[model samples]
Target: MKRCKRVAVVLPVAAGLCLVYAPVAVADADASIVSAEVSGTLTPGARASVKVVVMNHKAPAGQKSCISAKMDGGGGTSCFDLGAPGTSVTHDGFMEVLKDAKPGPRTVTVNLLPRAVGGLGKDTKTVTATVGNAPPACDPVSLNRDAFQLGHTEGLKDGREDGFADSYRQSYDDAFKKKPGLTAEQCQDFALSAFQNGYGKGYETGFKEGQAKGGKVGEKEGKEDRQKGNTSRNVTIRQLRVTALPATGEADCAQGVKFTASFLGSGTGTIQFHWERSSGKVPGTIEFSGGDAEPKTVTDQAAVPAGATTATLTQKFVIDSGPSKGKTAQATANVTCKK
Candidate 1:
């Protein structure tokens, strides 16, 4: 059994309206499987673990329903009631069958029963487990909480052992006292330090290892696939925001024009400012300055190339791309998502 190491699963969307529909699909799709994955190699008599998670798949939104294991190799089968609702579920290896000699290709069918009813939906996914193989040396990783990023290990615990309980206050103090804005990397660093200092130091190892893996931050670089050619994964945005400062243009060619996306989203993502020609003469060399850590303006505004009607601008988040396909994204572009 070739165990697929993929963690997240991309589910089916409706006929159209990709943006507003993902959460809906995850919540309402009765027979569809969002993500069902497995980790670990089973040796004859060795214990392996399986994990699963769903997005708003059941009542209370965050809780996962139930899961069971069925052995396809010579090994026997068992099920874990989970005993309660959770957004994620995990179970250790088959204790009874670990001593058996069931080797070679096998399958561990992970059935996610959301509510003891139609919760598992009509279509559920199954991942394979290699009965005999050289197991990975590193400890398993995780991608818990609200989001799942790519080109990065899914579940790398920071140094903090007690979750957010002991470290948030210290982290907030450091971030506020030292800088005006915090990047993801910096936040992770702060989190790592807090987790490490409060906890032992083991939790710090996973993250460094995960980051040592050089990868960009984004959806296209990891386990989940991006809905290509579709707006679900790719997009072009135009943000028109009302600023606190007056809209009066300055006479100085250098400081006259203005741009702001770089100033928003807490610097977590890039913001491109294009002078909507429809509004006014797209000012030449529009300069940008923001209340971010790197508080310097792009004074040497790049010249707009010939044949360009609206200025071409780009801003990117310092995130890793995919181990899967494109990922689901939410943005504030001044346009409607197509179905």
Candidate 2:
């Protein structure tokens, strides 16, 4: 940590980062950190804090220690991660970063890391200011948001007809700045908590972890015989539709898609909201304005839009009078189909 051009900041459970950035020294380290609370956006007042952790590599087994400091990146030496070694002392609410002033790349003072925990008396070469921050990557947001909090709730399976999985990974990870030196087991659970809040009732995103794929023993013979004799029919009970047009300028971690749906034709007799899965299909839902309505009302409905693959959507309504009386109505929720 002392007299170094490139300091490696090793994060436990994961390798450290290379603090091969810039460094700036200041006459008063503590005063500068207290004065440099970078902030932005408070349509929502921004809350900020500084963590100063000091470490003594050569200190004796049972003696107290001293600390020094520095900053870098912006013209001011007000940026850093830790100041105290055995403990992380933090300071908050000193200054505010302008909402309009774009945040430039931020770097920590590596040399300052050791100096913060002041060197031994008369030991000028013990530890000096270096450049870089801990955990390597600076996640300002994780500091602000809970690891369990759902940030950009787009495509939550609980809220959608089909559970959206793959899309939520990054945002979930972003919410939790996992603790330093976290274990592998801890990491797995850490990842789970990030998306836990997203799996609210009515929407279960994860799979049933322990149940077997095969049927249970001591099954009823009547049901087994009926199942062997009966035919399996596909039913498209509900559909999904979205209204937003292909949006331009999606956020850094989003891919916005938009579309609309309709149940233009009617089932001359009975009608019902539906759900179904085909040989190869994604689960979807029927549009509901909170109450049961006719198919025309189903027209121009808002849903998650047609996905990349195609599926046949059969509207299961009865038409009693026609030669196909009592037969279900069939339609395709296809992109090329007429609205």
lDDT of 1 by residue, 303-332 (tens): 333443323232221211111111111111
- Measured against the true structure, the TM-scores of the candidates, in listed sequence, are 0.25, 0.19
Task: Give the Cα error of residue 288 in candidate 2, in Å.
Answer: 49
User: What would you estimate as the lDDT of candidate 2?
Assistant: 0.27
Off by over 4 Å in 2: 1-18, 21-58, 65-69, 72-107, 110-198, 202-339
Whole-model lDDT per candidate: 0.32, 0.27
lDDT tens digits, residues 1-339, model 2? Answer: 001011122223322222232223432223222222222211111212222333323334223323332232222223323323232223231222232333334432322322235533211111112222222232434521333344114213223322211222222222222311354345445544544433342133222110111111102221332345422111112223323232221111122223233433222222233322232323233322322233443332223334522222332233222111123343333222111
lDDT of 1: 0.32
Local error of candidate 1 at residue 172 (angstroms): 38
